[model samples]
Target: MSTTRPQLPDDRPEQGGSGVDDGAGPAAAVGRRTRRLTLVGASGVVPMARDFAREALREWGWTPAEGADRKAAAEDVLLVVSELVTNACLHAEGPEEVLVSTDGKTLRIEVSDLGSGEPAPRTPHRAGRPGGHGMFIVQRLSIDWGVLRVPGVPGKRVWAEVAAPA
Candidate 1:
């Protein structure tokens, strides 16, 4: 399955933590609180959603330290985001949403779609197929990932987390 990319909002402000700016001027002090970035109707918004999540994490206080530390973690997070979002768009019908947040120690990524079907890893024979590797990749890269059925929502939310690089 394939999908076209969604139009992202161009007016998003320079990222900040907790949706708030500290008194230390925009450049003075980095915010320490966890921040939430949400993308609604993510049917075709996979790429943009990944970018949004990365930017939100950077804005929330994560910075690349010396010697390939934060960059690797950032890449992993982006990859997982892409996999999860793409899976939602391809397997689910109707609108989709993505929620990203970080608790300093770990980053949380979640994608929700209108389709109630839960995702499962493909078998070894199916692994050679062109599609269906998204969920598998997510499972491999994330420390932990799973699906949750929300009471009021029409679909399940697939979520994953990776430890924040020190």
Candidate 2:
């Protein structure tokens, strides 16, 4: 599959964890950046998702910082991306596009696919199972996440929002 990172709006603030202030502004109220990726198929979508997230994090200043928060944020982003993309690849035909956006305080991830079935976290919590923890992980890590059906469209968009590093 092909992965592409388009240029986001320049007005959005860049999220850097150094807290050294690169003159971007206060981290609390930083602007937003949204990156969209169009995937051709399921093959290698996991790595593609990770790469897309990594590039966005670097651009947003999620580099290694003094505190663990920065690292945690980066890891969370990667994990969330992997989980969501993997879910799409496994359950649906494949992901059509993945959108990752951040407003310094929170990171929002959305995976759109050509599937109508809604994704739900498995009930009863099968921790010992070979799999089925993807949505569970997404639920635990994200502040909020859910599936959205596009009006008059054939597919749905699964999305999650996680708090950025402190």
Candidate 3:
């Protein structure tokens, strides 16, 4: 027997710096279900980050989901996670942390890195192009995405938000 879970509310983003006690830290699930994974000095950061996000989604009850829409939504969240982490690995001197969270209505993925480069969808987006498509993929899958310059820090946090299924 399965019980229906209430829809999540559209809550505000979580606050604070991009610090995590590696991937073994405690996760907070009070208001926002969030998991912060440290990828610095970790090998295979991208896959590890995605796996972390997947676990978070499962813990948040986003997976083992019913219906096609909900499943697709979950998949989109993971793909965006992969893209963001991959971008950090390829261009941002590797990611320092990957943060995954949700407030019942929207799922958010954030990747923090020390690279000073700003991320944006390539202008005159060429779908035929082989490289430089990470941000573009992010832009397409996510309802909204942006970069936040970590205050007093030499890095930026790239975040993307995807709407939760009703």
Candidate 4:
């Protein structure tokens, strides 16, 4: 199988940087569009998937004013990705896809699996269970999250968005 890094938009302007014209048009006013990074499957590619997300954040121009904030954000993104991917791999069947995107203020992570099963978040008191804590952690960390049911597809997409640190 081919391992390819997804393409990111080249002309998307930075929001707070100088030389960025506010009157550049509606599209430019929106600033840089979030790029999608996809991983075909969870097996054997988890580490690479995490690294890809971190690199994408850097490439999208999210730099920390001080030490390690950028790294922390990247790590947070990676952890969320790992949790979603692991849940899909463990509970679902067939190929899986992971997509990560950022819109300057928030980072969105999505994992698609071929299995039709929906992951329900268990209550905190029941969190001591051997498994089933993935969605719970996701709920606690993400600003908002949900599932998307794609017609004609055997499975669904579970997505989460975390607010970007100031």
Best-performing candidate as measured by lDDT: 3
- lDDT by residue for model 3 (105-151), tens: 88888788898887877889888879888888888888888777635
Report, for all candidates in order, the number of backbone clashes: 0, 0, 1, 0
Candidate 2 error regions (>4 Å): 1-30
RMSD, candidate 2, Å: 9.0
TM-score of each: 0.70, 0.79, 0.82, 0.69
How well is each residue in 125-162 modelled by candidate 1, as lDDT tens digits?
Answer: 37557887887788787887777664664676677878
lDDT of 1: 0.63
Model 1 regions lying over 4 Å from their true place: 1-44, 63-65, 125-128
Residue 153's C-alpha lDDT in candidate 1? 44
- The stretch of ten residues in a row with the least summed lDDT in candidate 4 is 1-10
Best by TM-score: 3
Candidate 2 has its poorest 10 consecutive residues by lDDT at 1-10
Q: Rank the candidates by TM-score, best first.
A: 3, 2, 1, 4
Q: Give the local distance difference test score of model 2.
A: 0.73
Please report the TM-score between candidate 2 and the true structure. 0.79
Residue-level error in angstroms, candidate 3, position 41: 0.2
